[model samples]
Target: MADDRFSMGLFDARIKDQRHQVFKVLGMYFVLMTVAIWGLLSLFWGSTYQLESYFPSVKVYVYDFDSVATPNAVLGPAVVRYLQSTLSSPVHLGIIVRDPAGKTFDDVASEIVGEKAWGAVVINANATSNFEAAMAGTGGLLDGQWAPKGAISLVVAGARWYQVVLEYLLPYLGMYVETPVLEASHQASASFLSTATPATLGELTSAQQAALGTPFAYQEVDLRPILPGQWAGAAPLEAGLIYYIIFAFHIALFFFFSRLPLQGMTKKHGIKIRWIHVCLLRIVPVLFAYFILSLAYTLINKAFLLPTDGNGYASFGPQAGFMVLWMLDWIALASLGLAMEAMLTLLTLKFFPLFLITWILSNITSSFFPATLAPKIFRYGYMMPFWHCTTATKHIMWGTRNRLGLNFGVLLGWCGVSLVTICLFELMWRRIEERKERQESAKDVEGQGAHK
Candidate 1:
């Protein structure tokens, strides 16, 4: 009995030593592999979507309803030219002038929505006459006062890209219009100071007041609105919800995957279960957590950002679609993660590979900016699950256009690939483990012989 107890103790010690050796080798290999991959990715795909790295360029369609003799023709061409010159390289203009006056705002809007141009500048037929009237202090709320009326209409796409374009263009255009008006006002003021009369003094002051700002009062029209009216004010909440939903899945993934090894080890000894069944069992909790979190997130967003007095879930088509897409996305990502973890464990039992993989995927996902804006070298990011996931999420929440079918295809493709890879690697691992066990048996016999 004492001999059997001693042998059991020795066997346990050997197993512990083998585990220590496995971990030591895996730790070193994981570190080296992670560093090598990270270095290569950074070298090839340098930071691509930085605002400071490049200036923003916009496509503009200009429609002039005024004839060559009118101020619209002169001012419209001049404004377009100024815009072309003012925006520096990497931020240059692509301006097209449409001649036909029949093109309506809807035509321009459709084009903008279709990604033809960032904005359209529409010069009304009455623009020149209106400008003249405003300058003459006639046909406006200004009975005797001089308040300029806007003649041109600025129709801009309401996407994030167009917002950036407008931020660069609008100020410069305003300054261009105001500069001439101010110069004329200054000249008039100087002229009137020398020849002082009651009428002249009033004229001088009126001219100065009118020229203090832009003479043109352009009306801004939104081509695409995320929410009805201006939702730019709620940008923070919108963005927060996106990040929250994404990271919530990520967090759940991290928590559940960490216990996967323990789950495998603690399987009932007498019961025989298929590997796929085991995988499905593990996935159930992740799905439950994901659904609950998704529901909570939707409730919060509706309560604050998209609040309606009635039942929010009644008109929850988009939200339901978003949830289904999110579920597929997380599942694909989780499957991919599992496959990677299994492959890495076969090579090295350390958890460092999981971290490395997660970190790399997070970087390339391009959640902060549109993947289109990313560098050409980083175009592989388009195939990543999270990129499509975030994109589909944006489309659902903010009403942005996206290829939902394509996104779904990409995610499912990843899942199929991962499951296949995991199966192959797991089979390979079983063979490798068998070989190692046989080798260990041989060593044990040799050690016994040496002891004898």
Candidate 2:
């Protein structure tokens, strides 16, 4: 009876001590969480506002082929002048003028493709002749021979946001180039018709000038359109929501498992199971929660459920292919969360700091802009799991036939690597526990020997 009372007293004391430790850790967790919330809000909002004051610099290579002959000067110089004038204030242009007399369109386009420049402008050789043809209303057929040709061709890197900015500015730039060309065309036509009737020429010239204010013609081709449709067509926020949703679920699951009680499987029931098995078992319940939440969210949104056309240009749909992709993505998320929780088990209190680091890094990821344009450190953010999830989700929803395979490869790779890491961590933890148990047994044996 006395031995039983002693063992009961010791068990009660141990339980009390454990309870105390749990309360202490919980208190610290609450305090840290409060601080983290405040700090995250301030940091995220502050950086966004600060980044607004600066404009990304774009480099444009301009090759002018317009002949500077008399009667009508080349419009190549006029195109450059207009580009320089309008593509400013919001976008800084680094215009590199190549001698049109020597360089061909292929050379400049190749250079832009090589990343030597963001975009290129090639003005054809017959700009002067074409302007004269327009003035004469000859439909580019002057003196019985068609004018050699005059057109501006733009070749730009399509994936970068800064390059897109330059492309958008082109139409506005037509305002500058078109006004001067029309004025010159009007003067030439009025002069040619003056001998017939001055009053009639004046009226015709005024009317024609007003109607043909914008006569310059240009064509643009993006080197990396990636899809059939314009990259600009995808809303940045809609695409970014993929990252946000996965991130929320990943972090939440990480915390859930970190604080979960393992007594039932570990000791109370005396079940014989490996830690890896426990980790794998978690997926069943997690998948249930994920499916329920995802279904509810999808229903509420309705936008995601709409069938996509999957047109040659832009893919649109919520079809079976998308469902399979989403399922794989969910599995990857589960593996990611489990791996993080398992790895951090030994350093439980550090989860908050690690979470903060991940949150900040993800916020700075190049979602709306070109990854190459971001800071050197932020360029590495592409490797973050959330970034891959965002890319895959966006491509599945709206992108053309590009990068879907790569995205799937990356996600599945992360899952395998993370699971392997967790197994290694489990082995290490088991070894540590075994050593401690052996030492405690030795201590107990020695104490009993002394008592005997």
Candidate 3:
């Protein structure tokens, strides 16, 4: 904390112990940046291009059967072609054959629902005019049985994709009857209104008549925006993948810089500086360098799947912000490594344990695979700096607000902890160097006294 030490410590050390091949370090960093950034971007870009071209999403299936209709007896294929032509080319429907002899109408209906087919049309043998009258009008009889005069029964499957398609296309795609669905009559104001009315036919214990009311309401749910654009697979994964690789390299650079110089490399002027300062001092340049590479790849390789509203500047800006925040994980990891290195440097015992922690943290947090692929409670590194940060990358790239707050908080916390750790380690490292000087000076004095 002395004024002279403040002004001269790192500066005097840099000038005195400067390497003849400091040129070599710059060269190594260039080779590293070029190879690491170029190779990853190339491989990822190609993979993304091929996958997008090969796969088309959203497949639809339809089944239409007519036993009673004298006209257009084979209606299934025509219906399939019509539906396919109505929707986009990628949205396709295949016909499923249903023989009147093989299964009953209801049995085939159940099969349509069970096979995960989107919907089925059934045209029974009794094509009576009273079918519509049976369906409406106080449950009137059509050939002595009940249903709308022209209504045909449709059994439809409801799943994520099926429902998403059905919500919009169902109204326009299905077979046309005057009534979209058959409505049953029920009594409104009476004792049966609460529960005494039949909830199901099998559960009915008493007979009851009820008035039926019908006012049609329809629904359609679509997740895409008004101006739909698609992004998927490797394109979306690129930002995080680069962040991981750069972060890993940064970690290795930190450790390598902190390593002791080759033996017998001491300077002539009695000035000694440990390797920790080399790593810490270069943080600014290293960050700027990594950011420049990231910006280059993002702008050049449009192949990376980014989910965006397509503001080029917004994508570039947020991506840069994400990279800076992502870098914090490794930077914090390096600081923790430096603190451990300071302890190991003083001990002069086994260094393997220190190296082990450094190596493991680098690999495990690198996002070659994400932390979430395992259970939430991973024992190996549940507490480390990058664990939560990689998770945040997924949320951020998803262009959702889902864990943005949590990810930012945890990463910022790691940075806070790492800063405190570096300050303490710097103080400890300086004391160790000063103590070594005192011991060497004492030995020299003793030698002089002996010679006298």
Candidate 4:
């Protein structure tokens, strides 16, 4: 007979049994993956759910320097009243009315630069007096005529949280505060103009007449601007973070594969290698590999012309910034990769994808959205690697805040924890493998005895 085992009929009983076993395994895997995917989806979606409800956490200071205006000026008080009324609404920001006493515009600007506040609204000093003087044509001339842009200033640090400032905070301020204040100021100016004498009106130049019609104009000042073409440099802090994690995982994987030949030499060729040496081999090479990979990664960014020098946006000089960024990438890779290496030893290739999904989702959620705009539970993001990395990267690229010490400390802490876990897990994995080999040896001895 031909090889019946290898050439079974379509309806053979053996074929039916094998097909059934394959289907059962596939069904189990499908169900497990479905549940795992649902859980990960919930985690990512929950981070951004009802995000607007947490808007109050993003604080903005509104200081009315024009509060003690001349008796006739209603612009400053009217704007303050309108902004205060918004505090009662369900969807309102943390609009704090700061005491202007002992505080100047420079002070408020400094506070924003220091990351003390997200943004600020300042009604300039002598705002009402200046408007009154301009309307009466009595103020000192500029460029041979008196003309002011506005009495109010909207100060922001756009590079702090670029998307949030542009999308939520700026729009909210425009809708609730700026629009009504401008309308009320225009109405008040028109009323004042309607009652003015011709002599007073004629004394006003064309510019002064126009200024009287809109006496409450406002100027927007972004302290730390995220200028055009700078988003390339910011990539590592955003979606590039996810890519970095993936690269780190692959680096661990590449090393894992590279070890197979050494294992083959030890097992098939009887080459002696100590277990402790093997463990060290796994970790020490990873550090060197990350150092080189990080240098390449930083160089790629530089090749793309991502600004590294102190271009008024960053404080570090050209070569110094590049060195700092390379060091950061090296630590980040080690922190992220070492943990995956530890987990891989325990979970093995079969189940590692489940852990990988959770790791990516958790880090991305924390880094992509500002904790201030998310639920209180997300405050833990402060401890996550991605959040610190993003914060530090922004500071390096855009000079947002100087927290390098804290950032480096946290990243190094992660590396230490991962290093410990890797060693312990590697030892455990070797113990399990040795136990399996001993069991197989015992079985072989019994079979040989039975054969005799």
Candidate 5:
């Protein structure tokens, strides 16, 4: 029987062949992982100083007509202050009024927008009270959202920081709109809308309490103790989805290329590992291995030279589980990669095709840089697994626990599909193996007959 003890012993012994290659593979893997981890650590380590260098510094030039020069001075500072109040102040960005060669506001916008400028805000004459009106009213003239009654050009860069400025732009355009995240919750306006509104100063007062209904509402989106930390502070659901896809591919590649070639970890004497069994076997091994990797990653990120702050105990188990579940997807990738390797192994190809595919996809996916930063056309491409894993790892390190559940779900899907694929491949191989055995036996019988 295939289950005979002596046969099993020989089968087990076959694994030793793989042992010869382990140290070499491990050395290569260690070098690569170490370089990557160190480079990442260096960036975050330097972020403290690098963050200060910019200090909200994006020099946005605002060229306006002389008529609005007085309003510009007042409006500029007010815009800067509003920005300061709303944003997390990592950058020092503001509008600077300059009339180079006495060019008109339109002239400046035309020149700058074409030269790859970030954004532009042109204030109309008598637009000073617009900010004041906005602080007091909802929106209409200088006191409303969009165009600010007389604003000329307020085009967004349509790139990385669009969301950051989309809602806030109206507040600065004519100082008329107030779109605060917390305006709906807790309902605390600046506690005072306009400190300089004529109506408030000239008419409304505490002494005339009966006439005044209530002051304007002010609110700010303050997520203090930002739960997931800086690395995982983004929209969790979307981010988690992305990371799940990326890591699925990475682990799958590692499994197919690295783990399988190690020999005994994969090969099993004459047993035809159907695609299903192949997939199942891989899933079991990798789930154990990968989760451990996740744990190792977490420990290093937390307790090492540079620790990523997060809820360690709560985070470690869930993130590791999520990371392991990704093997389903890894199985799919591993299937494709292994197929290529299998072809090379049998046919002696000059190079492994899967490596190129993995490398290319890895570059585009699981990148540390944001996919949204990619050109609008390419943004969706980044949603694939390669990018997702990078983001997911960051999420895990940042203690974003809720997303761990979501990642686990997505990864499970990949595992199921991969298991099916492996079973199919194994069945095909079994037939081939059986046929070869028959051919060899027939040749042996023919040789006996010739001797007779």
Candidate 6:
């Protein structure tokens, strides 16, 4: 009895052996987790590191409608020449010189609204004519109003990408587009004033003289303006994405624990259930859970009074828009939750947190930044669920391009992939468990025979 007690004591050889085994296990865990964390950080941080290098990928059309025959196509041609020169500069863009032959300003605006181009600098058809007339003191000018601003239309769809537009595109336009155009107008006006007869000089009114000072101002037409109230919509696109995955993961965890009692009843209380029924039991409840969770999630946006009327983009009324948003949230939740559920079977609880970090990082990195401004690798974000969901959310909230069909299709495709993988993984895990149980029972039988 003394020897047996000694074997179980703190100094026992068995205890010493187990300590080495524990250390070895911890060492391996630490090394692998460190590698995983570093790898994930690299992926997350790499996306935006050289974003400025890819600035030229953002296409901005420069349509020179004013370059046609007029007394002097000075302002329009000067603006286009200055903008084209910037293509070779350090901070350049995809400044495509669009043929303004048959394309009207409306056509250019449509291209922007349809997302064919990030933005446009339309030297309006009347740009030179209007400015020349204003300079000649013969054009229509309202009281204290500037006409050159209306001469050039700078078309941008803010809802296309609020952050990208605000941060990069708008500033780029201000620098490369607005600045050059203003300079050209001022120079043109100065040259005209230098050669003007006393009659032309005296004809200039105070408002017209002010307009001549800045002869070519751009009228910034944001087809889909991101209103102040709509700033709350960023939640779903940015930080809220992490919360979405966390919520889905918790739902998976809750149901996993909930199923344990049923599993115990089958094992300990001699209760029986088919494996297919078990799979259904796990999947169906989570789907319903996402449905409820998504509605509650959407209601938070609604409660905060985020616009649901598509901000003048879509035809959906307030109530219909709310329902659309709810449905979008439901599908987005299902896409995120189902994928987590599928991965949980293969990764299990021990290793799932690593996968969780990878999932969140991958989705967040791809969705948060515009792919055109990032490396080509991030263009894969176009297919990611978070990207599509973010795009659809913008469409629903701020009225960006209405690609609802494609967004929904991609999200549902992710759901389909998750569903198939869940079934396969569930079946695989079940087979593994059954095989372990069979091996355990065989060992027991062999031990009993040896005892006899």
Ranking by TM-score: 6, 4, 1, 2, 3, 5
Candidate 6 lDDT, tens digit per residue, 1-452? 45764456656685798888888989988998899879888877888887788888999998887777464677778888888898888868889998888887778878998899999988877776766666666764656476667777778998788778878887888777666776777777777878989987787788778776777777788888978776777887789878999999899898889888878978897555876886788689999999998999999999878888887668797799899889998999999989999888889988877778888888988787888887778788889888999988888888788889999999999999998899899888878988998999999999999999
Best candidate according to lDDT: 6
Candidate 6 residue 100 C-alpha distance from true site, Å: 0.7
Clashes of each: 1, 2, 14, 0, 35, 0
Question: Which segments of model 4 are wrong by more than 4 Å?
Answer: 1-12, 15-17, 68-73, 140-148, 187-191, 269-272, 309-315, 438-452
Question: What TM-score would each prediction reach against the true structure?
Answer: 0.63, 0.62, 0.37, 0.91, 0.37, 0.92
What would the TM-score be for candidate 2 when compared with the true structure? 0.62
User: Per-residue lDDT tens digits of candidate 2, residues 131-194?
Assistant: 5555455544445433322356667745433334454535433444465455444554454556
Candidate 6 has its poorest 10 consecutive residues by lDDT at: 1-10
Where in model 6 is the C-alpha error above 4 Å?
1-14, 69-71, 198-203, 270-272, 444-452
> Which of 2 and 4 is ahead in TM-score?
4
Q: lDDT of each model, Cα atoms only?
A: 0.53, 0.53, 0.40, 0.80, 0.41, 0.83
The lDDT ranking, best first, is 6, 4, 2, 1, 5, 3
What would the per-residue lDDT of candidate 3 be over residues 104-181, giving only the tens digit for each residue?
655654554343444555544332222222223333343443333233444443321222334433553353322223
What C-alpha root-mean-square deviation, in Å, does candidate 4 show against the real structure? 2.9
Best by TM-score: 6
Which runs of model 5 end up more than 4 angstroms from their true locations?
1-281, 304-353, 356-360, 363-383, 391-407, 447-452
Give lDDT tens digits, candidate 1, residues 267-301: 54423346666455544555565556556555554
Clashing pairs in 4: none
